[model samples]
Target chain A: MDRTAPLPLALLRGTATVLPRAVISAITAALLRGLLKTHPRLLENLTRLEPAIVHVIASDLPYRFAITVGRAPITLTVVDRIATGADAQVSASVATLVDLLEGRIDSDTLFFRRDLRIAGNTAVVVGLRNVLDREELSIANELEALCGPLGGTARRLARALEVIADSAGARLAAMHRTLHPPGTEAQDLTADVRRCHEEIAALTARLGTLESRRKRQADKIA
Target chain B: MSIRYLELVCPAGTPSALRTAVEAGADTVYCGFRDCTNARNYPGLNFDFDELCAGVTYAHARDCKVLVAINTFPRAGDESPWHRAVDHAAAAGVDAVILADLGVLDYATRCHPNLRRHLSVQASAANAPSIQFYRDHFDVRRVVLPRVLSVEAVAELIAETGIETEVFAFGSVGPMSEGRCYLSSYLTGLSPTSEGACAPASHVAYEEIDGRVLSRLGGVTLNCFARGEPAAYPTPCKGRYVTHGQASYLFEEPVGLNAIEILPQLKGAGVTALKIEGRQRSRAYVAEVVTTFRRALDALERCDEGTPTGQLHGNTEGGKETCGAYQKGWR
Candidate 1:
């Protein structure tokens, strides 16, 4: 099993810190936008009522993005910078955003208790929530493939060649999270996330045992 | 000359409401087209273009005025619909256009220079500087004050700026800053300032669990009511929440703002008009509130006692009444 994806994991844990927050946010936004483009079908399946303006105000950065949709359309704005003219705006941490996208966090319980904020278009935000509902599940298997074991390993030798790029990306992510505190609401939201992680671990163990038994029985039949 | 009987500015959400208000006692009735251009964008409410023109003629024949409320803020790249609503309002020969947006105000001032403009309450222009800014920029003749101000503040503001003020004397209390709030947007992704309806009926669902009705906005539970208790409209600001570990109504309790008992005070405060707030209400509700307030105003003129305090409480969502921020000491 490739278990040592050190760079990205280290970045998420707030260890690597050589890059600036602005550059990191730009890169992250670009990554999300790239993901959207690659997964256009996912967007099409989401919702018919597109907000005219979609604002993304990252709490861990100084930038705010205003995205507009339709003609005389709906506007959604996220305000970490806290400007105006958004249909839907949210303030949360990078980890929480990933967790939310992955279906690891429930937007309802978290948002209602003040984990995230939907500012401009309340109905549209609520309606489109299912779009990002299970994004983490979609990318999990691909990410796991990139994880390499640590030390005295073939993956370690391969990483030496990729060290420059991976290390740089990790450093950038760490620095951005430090600059912005991910806001108070995000703090409240993450309070119960650890419990959820433990629950997922337990479920995974049960599924693994079931798969293993099935494989053994198939071998006997062969 | 005795200040011309305070112009009875009434609200009309439907074509029937228009005639009802005019007949009941409204000197002027304001309404909007059947789109987001108007604040009360409720289903089966407001006017179509033809209906508005006919309503204006009918009101005019009775020597009453018609004011079209195209009050919602226009979206950033698509302001044509709002501009068209104003053009249509003027073309229909309505007395004035009530506006709130800066860009819309600028457009109206230049595009239809002859049109009279009343500032919509959504503008929330409370102080002299804010009131003067609209007056200097758009030549706004009268300002509809947000419900947050007290009678004392209203008097001081009018004295300082000499701007005509219209105070909300009847109907629901909107807790947040009008037009600029996004709390509702955060939960539902639709807003009154832009979509022209807060806690829109489309996204609202009511579920009965164990004999209690739980009102949900966008599927998030807001409040639960007992079998016989009167349920309030699920406005996000008025929804119950946990603040400092105590589950309470954090923003505001769902109550109506009825200022009938303070007619003399508002008149003394130099309010030019008393506005009734239910445009989405039925014609019967319009007639009742307007007729009651009309009689109260007439009583004020003759120095007689009027509707007792708390008389209109049952008309409210929660069967509760507040002087609102009008008596700021209530805070």
Candidate 2:
């Protein structure tokens, strides 16, 4: 196993193991409450939806949550394990889930591509998707709101960090390209070999013509 | 100058869109309930009960009529939802109810006799006799003609039936017979007639592979578009498929219908209303389309030959527009 890969994996596992379920559940519930408060349409639409327990699982992470909607004060409870019975169970990578929540990517596109998997009652899932699509949900904004008085400073710092991270990622990609420069070098070698073969063939053809012409002239003189 | 103006019917997916359409000079605005009562049942679309009521009140106050679309077919065993939708639409005090199903139409006629009923395009009542059946049986005030007729055919139908005719002025050029398309259902196991959604959002997806974008519906790749090429809705009819060892658009190309230039012809053909299709679109789209058409209709009323077709080109699907089936040569 690669040492760098294992380090990140071990760190993620450690974090998952160290975090308490109740703490995560409380945090999730609190965040959801804040989201509902800021965007009342989310809750209002949910009230119109049929009562269902929707299990949202982050496939790449050790995170799962079951949300009970279609009632007053919709609740979110983080589950340590997958629920036995769920009206709808939607699973995707953390990045994908974040993209969906942030409205950066459409869920329907992901669902069709098999990047997002939805099992059990499709109607409930459809209803949930419809309700969520109506609102532009941003976890970053939600987190910033949690910062209270320091929200502006926190947002600025976050933006600076993002810029730095993006540049670093681009640099790393460039370095990677330098290390393994795709298949261009191999393609160039093939083209060079083909050119050499064509040159040799052309020279052979010209030499044969010259010898044949000289032989014909010598025969005429004799 | 007694010039008979064609009524400009526009779509409104939300309450805000309804107001936007009306403000942009829609003579009539049509919408549906938030459920599976009407086509264009995408997620985050349509109006709830309160929204519909408010939309009706808002439109009526401005001398604009609001038509409620309860156009989807009622399921065999359960007709309560359909019945309830009709009741709610009537209670909302809409100017009319656009219906397709025979049973639903009969119920509306029997129950709410005073409410005006327009035959939805979903009924596929293209011919005079079919449209006459609806008028005779259900007392349909107007027939929203299917998008399969030519200008001449529409005129002939109007002349023969002597009933009001509404034609699709703009939107997707549906080649298939309305209310009879089972292509989406075949792929996704969801009926468009019953679910009121074709190529439903839940079953539709987009993926990028090798710089090409592939639109899929229910895991079946419908169309693969080159980079920077306009992508269409992943409907089965507009999909490219292998035929005779060549891959090409088998049914129809992804093109939108825009008949702004032909407003005078449609008016001359005795068309009562010109329906602009796109309730699932944004309020901005509603405003632009309604405003452009309003200008065109105003010009027609003045007997002017010029129309603002160039301004409406950007709003078309795939940035390409055609007078589909309106011109005989388009067939």
Candidate 3:
């Protein structure tokens, strides 16, 4: 057996490139939905905990994924959609995760060598690694080799699935609105410092008001 | 009683404290760089590159080991500085580099296989599997347990993994999981877990209204204290809040974790080291805390179970301290 065989391009690009952000985002939602469908224990844990905020900052991608878990059970909120600054994030490609899951590459060594980093919910991340790191997935890699690249029709079909599951585009727009609110002083140092002082003063005044109210309430209760 | 040789791990936020802790009898001293690469990335606290080398030398001469904590999670697409920190810590001949991020751990393992690795409390590797996972992969030597566990739980963990464990003994106690908190980022657009400061002085607001004090962080009111009340720092999780139309401390009350009383139980639990948690503190505070722990450890070593001790009650936040989850069921 060729244990050192190269990975299928589909396994490689499917996660990072072939699947558009919208599609991958949708698939993430669907995959999570599927997991919740069968795993009663996990569902109970999540429900008891209300939800877990996932802050996925992919090191190989030009975006960050942030989602409020309590509100949307099946939504992927992608933020900073486009790569702008030199410090823009890059998410791990599908190929890399597949290679990692298949034991073809050591995830720790790769990450240490500056090859991988999947941030957010380190514990849940351990669960995700467990799900993907299956011997069966390695066998599927060979099957993927035979299936070649998905044709245009198949890509369109996958895109349609993505469109149905992914609420990323709308969420991205909302995040932009909140992050770059108009009229807030931009990153100008002078303006930011002044704004900072004003914010501090405002908070101080608010604290005083709350203190008076709390004291009055305590007095009345006593 | 079977003797437990508990190692007194102390903080040396500055070079002076490094020397002070060693002279005062600290078994190991942990410090960090003068940047956000470490959790204690306070201004004027951490060591400069040259100072780090010198501090390591200073501690080594006194038979004390120095550990560099580069514990913050790296920013997206900008991991060069964290990598450089690990490389520098290794090159400086420090005893170990305490790390949290898996990427940093991976880098350190491959780049400096000879460099010792200790799990930062920030990883929150509370369970046996997580600890074993790190040990199996990164070959981590020790893990600093989060403040959430009880002494019994700590004992169970030590029994399960047989891995050296460090638990926080004193300092400002964080309510939420370290390195995983996002409340500040959600409210203030800055995070302590990532930014190395919480309710950062930049966003915090303090105002006196009608002789009462109110504290706010990122526009969210944390607490309102009367004139005589001691005002706690306005962190998001530890602050007072309005929930279900009721105004109170929803997540946690205003207090800090003080496990100084549970020193014996911690030793009994097979914990190899006891960490003192303050890095953004004054050198005076470091001296007092380190000296107290050093003496207590010595007494415990001598099996003087009824040893008289000096009081550090005034040094604790809220002027009081609890054994945290070690004794009481804190859920």
DockQ of each candidate relative to the true complex:
0.02, 0.07, 0.01
Q: What CAPRI class is candidate 3?
A: incorrect
Highest TM-score model number: 2
Candidate 1 Cα misplacement greater than 4 A, ranges: A1-222, B1-4, B243-246, B306-310
lDDT of 2 by residue, B1-331 (tens): 1223889899887676788888999999999987788987866678888878888888988889999999999889888888899999999998899999999999999999999999999999998889889999999999999999989999999999999989999888887999999999999999999999998867866556775777788889998877666666678999999889988888888778888878888888989999999886656567778888888888777877666565665556566788999995843
lDDT of each: 0.71, 0.80, 0.68
Clashing pairs in 2: none
Give the TM-score comparing model 1 with the true structure, all chains together: 0.59
Cα TM-score of candidate 2: 0.66
What is the lDDT ranking, best to worst? 2, 1, 3
Measured with C-alpha atoms, the lDDT of residue B114 in candidate 3 is 96
Model 3, B1-331: lDDT tens digits are 1123678788886676677678877888999986778886543347678878998888888788999999998899989889999988988899999999999999999999999999999898999999999999999999999878888899999999999999988866665787898887887786666677665644665555775667677777778776566555567777777779887877767566677777888888989888887665444556677888877877887988774445765566555677777776756
Q: Residue A58 of model 1: what lDDT? A: 49
How would you order the candidates by TM-score, starting with the best?
Answer: 2, 1, 3
lDDT of 1: 0.71
Candidate 2 structure quality by residue, lDDT tens digits, A1-222: 111111122233344456788767666787898889988888988877778898988876566789887787688887756456777788887667766665455454453344666665555676776576556566666656777889668666666666666688799999999998898989999999999999999999999999999999999999
Clashes of each: 31, 0, 14
- The lDDT, on a scale of 0 to 1, for candidate 3 is 0.68
